[model samples]
Target: MPDVPLTDEPLILDRQPLPDGIGERLAAQLRFIAEADKLKTILRASPLAAADRRENDAEHSWHLALMVILLAEYADEPIDVGHAVRLVVIHDLVEIYAGDSPVFVPGAAADQVEREEAAAERLFGLLPADQAAEIRALWDEFEAGRTPEARFGKAMDRLEPMLLNWLDGGGTWQLPGATESTVRAREAGVVAGSTSLGSFTGQLVDEGLRRGWIRPDEA
Candidate 1:
């Protein structure tokens, strides 16, 4: 019967009280799952493949998970596709707290690491201790982009938006700070994980430029 004040909190569903005496661990895990659902509300600059509107973090993550499953064979090195799927699924849960930072936006990446680090702690801490540590480690591994799975995960992460942009007629590539030169440079690391995908991305980038959908680098 008390006032539930409105706040700037991300669009999260109201938690339903469990039937009395549910164990704290299960409750905590469920609460963390619900909290992470806020990823659905975090919008990114990349347009949907339909190009009708922008996609949210949840959709983006789902797409990346599928991409990992389909494209793991293209990886430059052996990688556990299941592990890579996990990475893609959880990679943007941090965006629930930190919010989506669009790559094409100049200066938006400032303090991104610091913000995401804080968000990871606060968000994943919602889980029970051991589970929290495990998921947090995957999040960190994806961020570090060191291992084969993580590297391939990172490759899909970068490639998805590039594919989206090309599919959407240069989606965010038309935005400021997204010249062909910069995009190619930014996406060049895809090769570290998948030589095939990196080569394909190069072809797409060049085609976008030729079609005049992407901005050419200023001379």
Candidate 2:
């Protein structure tokens, strides 16, 4: 978003005066919209229930938004569904740049935190300054997971992939180090936002165990 020539041709300050009202705001917003298209290419570890290929970040974010609409009533505390939807969608825009870190794979990305922070800054900074800060704040709220909306958003975040795994013939459950116990520990946070979702996630793991989809880990 530097002040380079807005035209297709090379820089020419003297070339016919710049348009009377070229809107920087619209330009930045359009750039962000175009950049977000890359999320569709950033594939995740979880498989789609109906497809053979892994789910992409854009698909994952859409599913989370739908979950907020359908499942917000199940939250442990009352939540703002609209706000929660925003959190879940904005939560992964960082991954558009930093890329995804698989939750089931231990040590998948050692510097995931650092990478995501930098991604957040660069991606959101594509917007107008005020809008950039606003969107980034939503991302930070989801990461903090303190507010009611954030907690439920976090719950949906963990639950979606687990649900997909269950529906997709074990999905990521077959990854190295994945086990009933470890999955439970990682996904139990779903309960922190919604006891029902927590219980449902437990049921999925139990089913995985019964069907021999995931191994039993004692450690």
Candidate 3:
């Protein structure tokens, strides 16, 4: 099976006569797209900068992809911008099946990984075999974070929510029990990609504290 182009609406393959093998592949692509639409309903812990509602998985992926493009220059080392963009875009797709896991939440890491891995396999499998392999590989690379692209991709993933939290007056961080240490610990991954970004986020943490949006960690 081959990759098929995605459309905003459900794919309409009836108009044209696809070659025998191609039709099934196209249908498979359509099915995957439909399945992916579920991502729009899975909300994350971060809120939109200007909106009252929380950000959803689909929106988060798009924002992170754009951030990857704009912030590529800040990466610790040179990276493949295109590959990084693909990595970010597909990174959250698994959440469609596994659901969004809030970083500050405790004791969920191991379970989240197991659930997301299962979700990745099931969701990616919906695509045509070749396309599925390509997407699954991209997801895996982003998860591993061994490559520069993956590192930067993960950085954007961590940074975007922090930025949003600050912009929304510490939206998620405003939850009563949240503290500086916990938030910083959760977002520490940003440092691996860019010390500059990490420093910038540290400043945001300070600002969050000053503005009384988050509590300080107990010594």
- Top TM-score model: 1
Instruction: Mark the 10 consecutive residues where model 1 has the least summed lDDT.
Output: 1-10
Per-residue accuracy of model 3 over 58-136 as CA lDDT, tens digit each:
8899999899888889999999999999999899888776777676656535588888888888779878899999999
lDDT of each: 0.83, 0.83, 0.81
RMSD to the true structure for each prediction, in A, is 4.1, 6.4, 6.1
Q: Candidate 2: misplaced stretches above 4 Å?
A: 1-21
Candidate 1 — which residues are off by over 4 angstroms? 1-15
The better candidate by lDDT, 2 or 3, is 2
Report how far off residue 135 is in candidate 3 (Å).
0.7
TM-scores, all models, native as reference: 0.92, 0.88, 0.87
**Candidate 3 worst ten-residue window by lDDT:** 1-10
**Model 2 score (lDDT):** 0.83
